[model samples]
Target: MRLERAVDDFVVQLASERGLSANTAKAYRSDLDALAAFAGGRGAHDTSDLDLELLRDWLWQDSRSGLAKSTIARRSAAARGLTAWLAREGHTTADAGARLRAPKADQHLPRVLTRSQVDGILDSLAALAATGDPVAVRDVALIELLYASALRVGELVGLDLGSLDRSRLTVRVTGKGSKDRVVPFGVPALRAIDEYLATARPKLAARNSAEETTAIFLGARGKRINSRTVYQLVASLLADLPGTGPAGPHALRHTAATHLLDGGADLRAVQELLGHASLGTTQLYTHVSAARLKDTYRVAHPRA
Candidate 1:
C-alpha cells in the first residue's frame, strides 16, 4: 500500500477509533505527510522500503535543521505508528520503526506571573476598559476569565452564552480528549464578565447576523471572535509586560495554575480545576511555585 493510503487510514483511525478531535487528527496527518516526504528523500518511498535506519536519518536531518527535539520525537512517533499500522494491515511484513529510539524532549518549567504582576496586567486591562468603547470591557473580561479559569484559547473562544452558569459560578468546558468539566472562576472574572454582558455583548450582538449569534464573545465585526484574533489580543497585552518570553493565552493558564498552587491549593484539586487528566501534567506548576518560594527566601532570609 502507498504511504498516502496508509495516512488516510491512520487519520480515520485517529478520528473514529481513537476519538481524536478533528484538529488533532489533521495534525497527525500533516506529521505523517512530512514523514512520508522524508522517507521518499531517503529512498524509502513505500512501507516495504521504510526501515529503522532510514527513519533515523530522517530525524537526523530534522535535528540538524534546528527543529525542536519535541518535534523530531513526534515525527518519530508518527513513523512508528504508521509502520505498526502497515504491519497490522499486512501491507508490510514487519514494523520497521517499532524499535526506533526517539530523542528526549526538554522539560523546562513554564513561566508564571507573580500576584502583583497578574494584578498589573489586569489593571492595565481595566484602564483600557475605562475607554468606554464597550469592546474594551469585552476584551478585559476575555482575559480575566481565561486566566481565572485556566482555559485553552479554543475553550475560551468556543464559549457560548448557554455554557455559563452565573448562579453557580461555573462554566461547562469541553477540554482536550473531548472531556467536559465545569470550571470555577474567581470574583474578579465575574466582575469583568458582568461589565461585558451589561454593556459590550449587547452592542456587538445587535449588528451580527442572527444565525451567527450564539457565541459569548463577539469580534469587532459582530461575529464570533477568531482564535488568531484572541492570540493577537493576548500577544499585544503581554508585549507591554516585564518578561520577554513567549506569551499567549496559555501563559495566562500557566500563570493561573501556578498561582493556584502557590496559594496552597491541593495538587489534585488544581488538576481538576485545570481539567488536566493526569496529576503529572499538573505537577509542572510545582516547579513554578518552588521558584517563587526560592526567590522569596533569597530576598528575605538575610543569611549571608
Candidate 2:
C-alpha cells in the first residue's frame, strides 16, 4: 500500500476506533503528512519502503532542522503508532519504527498565580460585571467557574444549560475522550453563574431570532463561545501578570490545582476534580507547590 494511503487509514482508525479528540487526530495527521512528504522525497513511497532506517533518517533530519524536542517526540510517537498499526493490519511485514526514539521534551513548570493575584483578577472582573454589560457578566462567570473547578477550556465551553446542578453546586462537563464528570464549584462561582444566567445569557441568546443556544456560555452573536474567544479573554486577563508560560485558560487551571494542593487538598481528590487520567499528571502541581515553598523559604530565611 502507498504510504499516504496507509497513513490516512491509520488516522481514521485513531478517530473511529480509538476515539481520540479531533485536535489529537488533526495533530497526528499533520505529523504523518510531514513524514509522508519526507519519505516520498527519499524514494520510500510505499508501505514496504518504510523500514527502520528510513524512519530513523526522517526523525534525524527533523532533529537537524532544529524543531523543538517536543515536536520531534510527538512526531516519533505518531510514526510508531502508524507502523505498529500497519504491521498489525498486514500492510507491513513488521513494525519497522517500533524501536525508534526521540529526545524527551523538557518539562517547564506551569505558570501559577498567587492567591492575591487571583483575588485581584476576580475583583476586577466583578467590577466590570457590575456595569451590567452582558458580555462582561458572562466573562466574570466564565473565569470564576474556570478557577473554581479547574476545568479545561474545552470543558468549560462545552457546558450546556442543563449541565449545571445549582442545588448541588456542580456542573457536568464532557472531558477528554468524551468522558463525563461532575465537578463542584464554590459559592463564588455559583453566584457569578447565577448572575450570568439571570442577566447576561438571555440577552446574548436573543441575538439570533430563529434559534436558541443551549450552551452555558454564549458569544456576542448568540452562539456557543469558541475556544479562541475564551483564549483571548484569558490572555488579556493574564497579560500583565508575572509569568513566563502561556497566558491561556489553562493557566487558571494550573493556578487552581496548585492552590488546592497548598491548602491541603488530597491528591486523589484533586485528580478527580481536574479529570486527569493519571495521578502523575496531577502530581505536577505538587512540584509547583514545592518550588513555591522553596522560593518563599529562600526569601524569608536569614540563616542562609
Candidate 3:
C-alpha cells in the first residue's frame, strides 16, 4: 500500500475508532504527512519501503533542524501509531516503528498566575464591564468562567445556552473525546454570566441575521465565538502582565488548577474537574504549587 493512503486510513481510524479529538487526529496527520514527504525524498514511497532505520532517520533530521524535543517526541509517537496501525491492518508485514524511540521531552511547569495577578486581571475586566459595553461585559464573563471552571478554550466556545445549570452553579461541557462532564463554578462566575446574559448577549445576538445560535458566548457578529477570537481576547489581556509562557486561554486553566491545589483541593477531584483522562496529566499542577512555595520561602526566609 502507498504510504500516503496508509496514513489517511490510520488517521481515519484514530478519529472513528479511537475517538481521538479532531485536533489530535489532524496533528497526527500533519506529522505523518511530513514523514511521507521525507520518505518520498529517500525513494521510500510505499508502506513496504518503511523501516525502523527510516523512522529513526526522520527523527534525527528533525533534531538536526533544531525542533524542540517535545515536538520530535510527538512526531515519533505519530510515526509509531501509524506503523502499528499499518501492521495490524495488514498494510505492512511488520511494525516499522515498534522499536522507534525519541528523546524524552523536557518537563516545564505550565504557566500559572499568582492569586493577586489573577485578581488584578479580573478587577480590570470587571471595571471594563461596568462601562456597559456589550463586548466588554462578555469579556468579563468569559475570563471569569475560564478561570473559575478551568475550561479549555474549545470547551468554553462550545458552550450552549442549555449547558449552564444556574441553580447549581455548574456547567455541562463536552470535553476531549466527546466526553460529557458537569463542572461547578463559583458564584463570581455565575454572576458574571448572569450579567452577560441579561445585558450583553441579547445585544450581540441581535446582530446575527442567520438562524439563532444556541451558543452561550457570542462574538461581535452574534455568532458562536471562535477559538482564535478567544485567544486574541486573552492575549491582549495578558500582554502587559508579567508572565513567561503563552498568554493564551490555557494559562487561565493552569492558574485555576494550581490555585485549586494551593487551596488544598484534592488531586483526584481536580483531575475530574479538568476532564483529564489521566490523573498524571493533572499532577503537573502540584509541581507548579511547590515551585511557587519555594519561591516564597526563598524570598521571605531570613536565613539563606
Instruction: Give the winner by TM-score.
Output: 3
Candidate 1 vs 2: which has more TM-score? 2
Name the runs in model 1 displaced over 4 angstroms.
none
TM-score result, candidate 2: 0.98
lDDT of 1: 0.85
lDDT of 2 by residue, 137-256 (tens): 999999999999999999998999999999999999988878899999999999999999999999999997788778999999999999999999999999998878989999999999
Position 58, candidate 3: lDDT: 94
**Model 1 per-residue lDDT tens digits across residues 1-304:** 6777788888898688767766778778988898888777766666788888888888898899999998888888878888888888898998898898878988777767677888887898899889888778889999899989999998998899999999888899888778889999988888889889889988887777665677899998789998899999988877867764468888889999998888889999999998887898899899878877898999999892
> Cα deviation of 32 in candidate 1 (Å)?
1.1
TM-score of each: 0.94, 0.98, 0.98
RMSD score of candidate 3 (Å): 0.8
Better of 1 and 3 by TM-score: 3
- Give lDDT tens digits, candidate 3, residues 1-304: 9989988988998899878888988899999999999999999989999999999999999999999999999999999998898889888899989999999999998888888989999999989889999999999999999999999999999999999999999999999998999999999999999999999999999999876999999999999999999999999988998879989999999999999999999999999999999999998999999999999999999994
